[model samples]
Target: MKILLTGISGQVGWELQRSLMSLGNVIYMGRNQLDLSQPDTITTTIRDIKPDLIVNPAAYTAVDKAESEIDLAMAINGVAPGIIAEEAKRLNAAIIHYSTDYVFDGNQNTPYRESDLTNPQNVYGKTKLVGEEAISSIGVNHIIFRTSWVYGLRGKNFLLTMQKLAREREEIKVVDDQIGSPTWSRMIAEITAQIVAKFQQNPSDFFSNKGGIYNLSPSGKTSWYGFAKAIFNDDFSNNERKLQRLIPITTQEYPTPASRPAFSLLDNQKLSDTFGLKIPEWDQALKLVLDS
Candidate 1:
């Protein structure tokens, strides 16, 4: 199988390169090579590659900065996926796209399901929702995985930020109100590869019958404060960072341009039942991330 992957530089994309290589020949492309902002470029790239599967992990992921850069965000996150879906439809290639938990407003008390109503609070969420809508409307063979709190060793993510802060600062304050699972990008890539392998084995069953949005996250949830504390505790045996000193603050105190979901935990039962794959607990994945 020939697979075309976008966003080679991203956390998930970088990991996907390894996971996807086992399945078949993998062609990785960065923004410079396949530039999602340009519909013509996306079309040309797809035509040239003619891949059997297209994995799109590229996105405009600056949650706070997206408020001021709506046009840029929408183009890359919203419109680009739509164009890719259209091209995929033409080529009869299956698409795998990554979405975010920000698609829903954080009003619900329980974990969000695949069928939950999406009412994004910020521009970033709205744009991601638009991308999901575009894929759904195109009526093609696609699977949209809506994940939360993604972090990896290579990218500018929460884990890296916490690691940096813990090394330099005496004390760090993290938001305690916002709650979600800290999904490792490597896990996401592994799950994507598993799904692809399944498809390769039974293409007709995988594409014709089962293809829709599924919430892909770890089993448990944690606040930003708890997550940071866990990171410090797991990494430093001497406790130099002093996890106890890591202060917990409310979201109100740490103000940003975008309003974060108070709780963005996603229910993974649907994904597990559909794919026959169990998501590891956030703690289990956190250890692997720290080890790396």
Candidate 2:
């Protein structure tokens, strides 16, 4: 199977290069080779490659920056995905796209299911939701995995930010009011690879019966402050310098241009029920990432 994987430079993409290798001829595309912001480039590339499956983890992920750069964000996050799905439909191929938990308003106390109504509060979330809609509207075989609070060692995520701050500053402040499951990027990649492998086994049945949106987050939840605490607690590297105290602050205390969902925990029950993929806890995934 010819698998076209996008966002090679991203944390999940970087990990996917390794996980998806055994599946088939993985044709990896970084931003330079396949920029999602450019629609013609996306259409041309997919047409040229003619992959059996297109696994897109790429998007305009700058949550706060999306507020200022709405057009650019929408182009990549919203328009590009529709183009990809269209191209995939032409080739009679399937697509696996990654989405975010931010699509919800976070008003509900319970974890958001796949069937829950999406009311994105910020530009980034709105754009992501638009992308999801675009793909589904195209009437193609697709698997949209909605994940939450993704972090890894390589990327500029919350995990790396917290670690860098811990080393440089005497104290750090993280939002405590907001709740989510801090999923490891590698875990996301691995699970995605598993799904792809399953798809390869029986593409027709997989798409006919199992194609839809599923939450792909780890079990359990925590606030930003709790995640920070877990990261610091699992810091196994010998180079420890500063970080005297860790301060927990409310969301209003640390304001941002983009309004995040106060509670964006995604329920992964559908994923387990369909794929039999039992993900680990958020903290457990964190420890594995740190250990590596």
Best by TM-score: 2
Model 1 residue pairs with clashes: none
Q: Which pairs clash in the backbone of model 2?
A: none
List the global CA lDDT of all models.
0.92, 0.92
Segments in model 1 whose C-alpha atoms lie over 4 Å from true places: 234-244
- How many backbone collisions does model 1 have? 0
Model 2 lDDT-worst window of ten: 234-243
Cα shift from native, residue 169, model 1 (Å): 1.1
Give per-residue lDDT, candidate 1, residue 278: 80
Candidate 1: worst 10 consecutive residues by lDDT?
Answer: 235-244
**lDDT of candidate 1 at residue 181, scale 0 to 100:** 94
Local accuracy of candidate 2 as per-residue lDDT tens digits, 14-122: 9999999999999999999999988889999999999999999998899999999999999999999999999999999999999999999999999999999999999
